[model samples]
Target: MAPQLTSLYTTSFLIALFVTLLVAACLRAINILPGRTCHSAKAPRKAAPATRILIVLGSGGHTHEMFHLLRDLDTSRYTQRTYIVSGGDAFSAQRAVEFEQTLEDRASETRNKATTVRRRGTERPLCVGAEHFNIATIPRARKIHQSLLTTPFTSLVTLVSAFSPLFRSDRLHPNLPPTTPYEIAAQDLPDLIITNGPATGVIVVLAALIAKFFNLKGCSSRSKCRTIYVESFARVKTLSLSAKLLAGVVDRFLVQWEELEGEGGYVGGHAEYWGILV
Candidate 1:
């Protein structure tokens, strides 16, 4: 009789587990259906639009190094670029503009030289890439050893600002077309988000990841909002606080040094030691 009772209990537990799993699966399917449907209908786009790229700048060396990286990028490919800088960072904004101008000037020089060499007006048009990059600012989330009492409030505000640009697109891009009712749904989330370690980056990245999770605006692909986190060149042996925190969410965690590879304690994917990016 005891053995029979045990058998009955096991059978009941299995049934309950199966029901729970079935319900959960159904709910998941319902939630994912909308994104999947839209993705399928729009996928295999005949001609993919230019990728919208966002680069988060953390003042000082972060800005300088990234400037070189951006300058070298193929502007024709990444047509829409957004630069996120922490508030009160006038230098970064200025630098971004300068970077743009530098490319333009160089392009002109190259074009003229080509024209001169060709002995006619057969030179190709300028290939200025930096002009595509746009800049926006967010307040810093924390200071080194910031007081715990006030950290939460600042962090909260910073996080909001990271997502705040959604409501006001014109303010960022004055030339943008008139927004429509579907503006909110069809908003352009960055196709690619790239950043290096800085306390401020943590918030911006976190916001992007959350938006991706919900299949919200600006995510080009329903299944992913590609984020790449490059460890600071300064840290050759260890990951910084921001890098470590962002390891799980970033689609790619790039290490500048060979030794630091696989140190993130995350199996999200193999950490690539791409050597120096700057």
Candidate 2:
């Protein structure tokens, strides 16, 4: 009777512990998740001197659309750019390099014009070179023709790996003083994370949410890792699988078509139509 009572008490304690943990997780999700109208506050204010932006790129169409959206990116304000690509995607990595090259060329032309205007004063530096940008590679959460049973395991691995790039990595800025704006951007959390519909993108954003939930590296306290998810322009009436999963999780959910403006009503927030961002 004594042994049986002890076993029963152990079972009860285990059940109580599980319930407590479940409740705590629910409460945390409620506190940190963004609401329908709570979008503007998550963004960095104009007064910020330097901001780091992380861009998640996927293969093929997703990669093509992302660069188009960032065609007007201002290198002066967004001092540091981090491009996250999935493993084995050389095309996306190459595209990022080409994009930076274009920025460099544009900067050179602007500098030449500035020099012609006035040769005496020093011009503010442009963040276009290799030092100002980095490309990080993470494993794909789900691969083509992958087994469903193994997908969850792969995705779990991806979720864990995603945190490495979100936080500051000293390897990327070796021997540099932390006081400089570029180094500071490297040492701190990203101000913004931009993504389109990609499996890797969803995992990366999820990792950011997890970090914010625990206030990892002051992510939530400092209001960093704010995400903007743009639905693919190809989707006119319906949201893609990735968009459906992340509509509520991302800080801003943008859809190009009017029909998908309020698509995520079932979730906390709704899709915002910005009129063909891509």
Per-prediction count of colliding residue pairs?
A: 2, 0
Model 1, CA-based lDDT = 0.66
RMSD of each: 8.6, 3.6
Tens-place lDDT digits, model 1, residues 12-58: 78899899999976665344323312322544643233456677888
How far off is residue 233 in model 2, in Å?
0.4
Tens digits of lDDT, candidate 2, 27-137 = 988778887677765456463666899999998899999999999888887888889999999999999999999999998998889866865554456778876888999
Worst 10 residues of 1 by lDDT: 31-40
Name the TM-score of candidate 2: 0.89
Residue 235's lDDT within candidate 1 is 85
Q: Once superposed on the true structure, which residue ranges of model 2 sit more than 4 Å away at CA?
A: 1-13, 41-44, 116-124, 169-173
